[model samples]
Target chain A: MSDNTGTKVKGQSCRLPRKRFYRARAHSNPLSDSHFPIPICPAEFDYSHHYPYFFPSGGEDHKNGSASPRKVRFADIGCGFGGLLVSLSRLFPDTLMLGMELRDKVTEYVKERILALRASNPGQYENISVVRTNSMKYLPNYFGKAQLSKMFFLFPDPHFKEKNHRRRVISLQLLDEYAYALELGGIIYTMTDVEELGDWMRSCLEDHPLFEAVSEEELEADPVVKLLTSATEEGQKVARNGGQTFRAIFRRIKFEEE
Target chain B: MEETAEFVSNAGEDSASVAAVTMDVDNGLIEDDKSKDAEVAPALIAVHPFEKSVAVAVGFELRLFDLEGNCSVSLVDDSGGPSHSDAIRAIKFGANGRLFASAGDDKLVKIWATNPWHCIRTVSAEKRVSAVAISHNGHYVAFADKFGLVWLIGLEGDNAKQSNNDKKAVMILGHYCSIITRLEFSPDDRFIASADRDFKIRVTVFPKQSLKGAHEIQSFCLGHTDFVSCLAFAYPSGCANGYLLSGSGDSTVRLWDFISGVLLATCEVGAKVGSLEPNGTEDAQSPISDLCASSDGSIIAVALQYSNRVALLSCDFSNGNLSVAKVVTLEENYFPTSLGSSSLSKCLWMVMGASNLPMPGSAQLPTRLRIISGLRKDPSDYHCHDPIILEDNEVPGGQKLLSELQGSLDVTKEEAALAAAAAAVKASMRNMMIKKEYTLERREMRKKNRNDRKIK
Candidate 1:
């Protein structure tokens, strides 16, 4: 196969050159056009005295040593506004799911949704969360390698204009980040409304040495994929307006660097 | 070096001296006695109160610091194989710290055995695993991912036949257009409480015998206007209130009776909370990043992210009232707060600070637990420093903070070698050429422009 750079990709799905990979940048205060201005947490929340629990330390002992292995299986990358997050929690009640988003507004929105979910279904929705974080910057922060069984990027900003492509959430550089974050056999599931953006994501995943397509049939037939089609806020919008929603699933393949 | 210092109480011009005091981090003690007199109080961040140690996730690793700063600090490596390659988002220490559970973007919820942290088992997920909360008895490990999926893993049966079996992934899904942010098992282990982005709290009662879903929708706590960031059950320390406090993007920590779904009290903090205008209208603010209550539920700590402060208030549930007791100022760079404390650990709560440390040179991203220790001292006793909530906030408050965390630095041997290799490569490509300066006059003109704007 030709390198991403060697090929002048015709569409968004084909792999682009490494140079086309997103160059991570800080978010601009995009103009918010809303009736009530979205609330944001104080920038300097005084943690001066409180300690943040980075690791498990409380009363989490398995009463039965034979109990379930303490393990996590699913992940969300750049979970914006957490629309998909709420959907996934109900779809896979037994599988642990995590939502990673960069914006505080988005994460906070998800937080309220989670608390309410837990309040209503204390038994079922207690296993989900939307963490406030820049996914591109912190994939390894929350998870261990090969730890995830699946990952998703749904309708992430395309950074459409050329100069802003570097700011796009998905790119060759981010592909490596995902590749390392995922376990062997783990899958990366992505969806985009823009065909060009879909091509961009496809190219990013396809070009990486570690990932290969899970087959079109597998992508279409997966039950979890149904949740993407039926439950997402954007999915509803796509259905209503007759907009196209393209999705691709890539599994991590074994690779030897040496 | 002193930047501009703001005061909670208007003292005299000499207040600048009080603000200038730096922490004597080496001695595990505050060097200045006079600065202690300042009224600026400390607020709680994230609280993870375990039995032996109160664990906090800062950046790449989890810091298992002492609850009272009297014991030795323990560190756990949260890096995912590569150098600084993992973010420790949610960490829960097993009973007696024998086994600990952690989850992050790596999509793996790893259960580590004690002493030398070894990954004994892992719960693999399809997406970034954001939150992991093991039951008090550790029978079920509940985890939520970015996709808003909640998974209940029953540890009772792990027959090898189940190995390599996709059948193990039993997921419960529902909740449209929102992400699940935080989840916790009720004190009895019979129920679970979860918070999501949609500003709703759901309670599910589990079956008595089996770890399977009880399918019982008990009640919904429906008052938060924005995402609820943190949720905690009333610690069963003689408190029969059965209350649940939720921190939200609305900048208020609302207390709810989990069983009845009644709004108990809303502890407001920051400009948004005080924004009750002269005309009784104010601009709304973001949700509280973190929340923690005392054992008796007398005091609740709210960590305000954009507000740049932490506030402690008295929660008078009997009358549904809240009064701000004190607010502590924090450094400007910190964001995304975490809070933790135990039943007796109420007077002092942990706050995780300066979580997202932009890598000094690169634009690469970061993790769940990037922590800094001893950023603030408990004002009641200045000599007593407590752990802040950042997961890496594991170090003891004073002298041993760095030494204790020396074991869990996210850097790996392979990554260290790669760093050395990269350094060598860069050295080989070095070009010794000095650039010309634009001249002192130009620099001064730029500085003057910035200063003029500040004056305005």
Candidate 2:
């Protein structure tokens, strides 16, 4: 398998090489055609193109017994280098998780990484994938209302200067789109080495009506929270430097009226 | 180190001084590599009534610091500390600073005694809260949530009501289908103005006689192209009537005369500020993040999203005209996320947030709170200081760490470690199951093919 890197592979999915992954700025969202050649609509987006394997999107039954109206319940926003996704892929073998990233190169790298993993382990890594999209703008386009169950903002890029705070994925306005996409009781997990960014996420989510801050006790009980601090490359980098990872988990909650 | 200082007023000039964060990349003034380690920025801030102490709310913790002593106020056994489970969105001190009210995503509104900082009453709402506002007298605490429903609960009555039965919160359908960002009661308390994400501001009469009348629309401040995030009232003419100023996602700030329901003036901060931006043509939308106007309404400060500068507008409500006083640029894309004004000589507090825009060598920079003092007829000085970083663990002194959060919560590091190990084991087992099932299926398919060939 190691010698087959340059050779043509046949698995329905195209064999993406490790070197093909390059960094390109996120084609700013709503793809106004000026930045991107074509504007994107959620309806026109074909999931089959990204996932070479057949996924039963409530339309057909699968060869394997796992075939209920299954959708990508887990989403990783700004998934830098796809470290967390690859880690979680084996954990939940059946759960479909999509990593939405801004940088084209990072997204390509994640897709290729997923392909390589799938090649090595047959029937595994099929549920994980990546897409290049700026969550700040096109989150609603990718995710439908109340469609997502879990969203991970792991080691997010903290806009250091105050001016770029809006560019930070977790603003009050963007939180609205997040809440819209997340189902009630859906948990949003955020881990950051930067305490300020952690505080910003906590404050924004706590201020919004859709999310409830899951206490550390509650966060610890869950298996997903465990992956936040150590699963990602950024998290690993922070650990190497002896820095603190402020892990905040918020659950999407609403009253009976909502 | 003062760069170019611009003043709409003395206080405005002083506010610019705190941190002195102005655009200096083009001027080659900033060293480009000074701030490392991201700092905790202020989400909401309240200056105590005594004027000696100010309460700055960052994330979920609310820390009260004595300005004179330059130290945080240590509460009784962390009783006066942050109690809400989520972020503290709204924190406001009552007139004279005796009482402070707060509400957040915890769906609870807590009013605390400012002296020792005791949590006197906690009012629970049905939904996660967005904005909280206390009346002029500080009796009724009104809060809004994601649904744009405003609920008011009385602080004093809450004590007795909790003893018997929880008093039903008075709900008002303030803004339609929009998340109400800012809710404020007028100085006279005649009307309460609410702004929402749908780009509309509604001035409704306060529920004086009946709760039903609380939603009575007095006038609508129309003409904002984007969602209004912050609202403030200013008495520019020094008259009883005031003008409402709103900052919005459209990167514009508009002043509206609530009584007449007229659009007074629009100050487009993004256009001028974009010129100073390095990559303005990269096609990112800039929104107006936060704003605050002085009591006199003489100076209005607007923080535009993605721009390193805060635009200060000097407006006169008398003639419905606004002029851009100066666009004070911050140092190297450092944006102010929150701003507060104290009446004592009209000082302005600016909370700085750094852009995480993948620069060459950008590390997590620390949060800085800059206070511009002497806005009135006094000496101007901008003081930029580090904010109080609230630790997650240090709640109290006595109890066992795990026991304090015993009932529904258990947050010990050991427990988390155990849970993590278990999870890793479970994940590996699941992966093995998938592999086993795949191999078995292939074997079964081969057996079927062999049998069919024999029948043939």
Candidate 3:
């Protein structure tokens, strides 16, 4: 870790390294920063690959205008490689989906996959998109407060050491961000194979202000249990290992008092 | 403050360095004596407490952490193989901590004894055990499972072989159309409270020295509109009249009169209360995520939905005042899932998100247990120079702020947006014209300097 002074270089505070840009039209990457400081290109909108048809419009309150038929119902946070999102989008055809990933390469890969899937099934193509941003900071920007019905926390990095616990995704601070993004009575779906992680999630959700565990009995009975058991990319791996999977669902609770 | 913290971290290169520093401040002999005493007391107290403790009970793995000098020591790892064909759902200590029991999804309840964590017996329940509790005297164990059946098992005697042979569960089926979520034994060991999905709390009185019949239903506490998710009887320590805290699907944690089935107070966490399903129907919103009452009954900590913020409230039950004393808000990614409190100190530990496994699947995140020891109450320190009162309107006031924002802010409202954009462009163009005209007028007066420039 750099010192705070080092963090404050020039006028920027820990400015991220500039992203490399490649030109598809020119079929070349910029070779000189001095001469080709800024690339000039017309912004193109192509939904053929990802959404060849019109977006869905059948959400309950879409009475005003017909924007698109594709309605986003599910989203995966930190979607790496786009494998899970693509699989889930196909599984839940009626529910529009999204994958928000921080890594540019992964996000690009997911977007490409969504596009390819859209090309094949143009009619059902509006169900997905990948956003590039740190999930923790961009949650409020990406989804309205309580806009998401279901949020997925796949295999998040576990900052295990005692001092590094704060860096872990499941902390008292991060749950608030999740709560804001999740719809009231909506669910935040999470699965982790690490016993400690599973326990951490259970403890966090069970103790979080926004959610309550859909008791072990209720969890078994819910229809979503099928998706939890078999659909998720992570769920299948746990099963193959003959590893015992600990699953718990936390439903957003409503405030009872005025 | 950051610099000072960094200095401190750098100063202590290792634990030995810390010890050396401590000895420099205090006499080496006195420090050694304190350290020696601290290490030995836990062993002395271990004999008197629960013989075998189950710390982490999930799936097939049951990890027990013993309470040492202000910390818990994991004992399950030390004594291996408390085997079950499936995961373990619930675990409890009985026989004054001598007898330990665990049950799981595979519908088998396995019993064990301590000294060395070892499986002693197995009690088979027809259904899966979802929750478990032990009597104060450690003679009787109570459990509720998937079939909504509550069972009372009596520990025959201290003789290991005889106890293993006579292990029997007296099953009492009563909950209708819903699975049981939580089952807990009252401090006195006379009453057991079981919460289920039907929103009804079943309290049972155990008959002494008997597993022959069934647990007599003492009372049925009912009020919550949704499923009863969690139930906690206040730890018996700093208060009288044990307070029973229950978290429900209604998003509210209600305090019961412990024995009388009377609703003392209800703490509504986040908005969504009174609604269970969000199909735009009347029954879709509920607020409470989960709730934990402090051991002394002075504080009830509730995890609120929407923001996943944990609200620590001071309970002035006599005055019917449940004031928001303090709030610890977490981010959106991590869900504050489960909460457990230490039997010794009022230390609170919570499991955060599930473990993160590598590759093709989602590995459940490790349960992060946090020990929230009571904040030192210094009345003198309460008065600060600056008190920032957060505006209620900034964040959702117990409501789903995201939904409210989404409902109001429609990005696709092009007609209204187009008009706003046109107006903004007009304003910007007018400002630009003014600046351009002003600059053009000034440039003409200074133009002669370039034309009349000297050759040099």
Residues B141-208, model 3: lDDT tens digits = 67776545677766656432354545567754334323577787777766778886545676655545
Kindly give the stretch of ten consecutive residues in candidate 3 chain A with the minimal lDDT sum.
A27-36
Per-prediction fnat:
0.00, 0.00, 0.00
Evaluation by TM-score, superior candidate among 2 and 3: 2
What local lDDT score does residue B344 receive in model 1, on the 0 to 100 scale?
44
Q: Write the per-residue lDDT of candidate 3 for residues A1-258, one digit (tens) a residue.
A: 112223446754343322133111211111000111111100111223333333222322342245533345676876665566666666666575667665556556556555555544555545677766555433433453455788777666554556444435555446655665567788877777777878888897876555777777776676566666466545777778887666556787763322
How does candidate 1 score on lDDT?
Answer: 0.53
The 0-to-1 C-alpha lDDT of every candidate, in the order given, reads 0.53, 0.60, 0.50
Order the candidate numbers by TM-score, best to worst: 2, 1, 3
True-structure RMSD for candidate 1: 22.0
lDDT string for model 1 (B354-403, tens) is 22332243232222223333433467896575434344344345334433
Q: Is candidate 2 or candidate 3 better by lDDT?
A: 2
The CAPRI quality class of candidate 2 comes to incorrect
**Can you tell me which runs of candidate 2 are displaced by over 4 Å?**
A1-258, B1-42, B76-82, B156-165, B210-213, B237-240, B275-285, B353-366, B377-456
Q: Model 3: what TM-score? A: 0.41
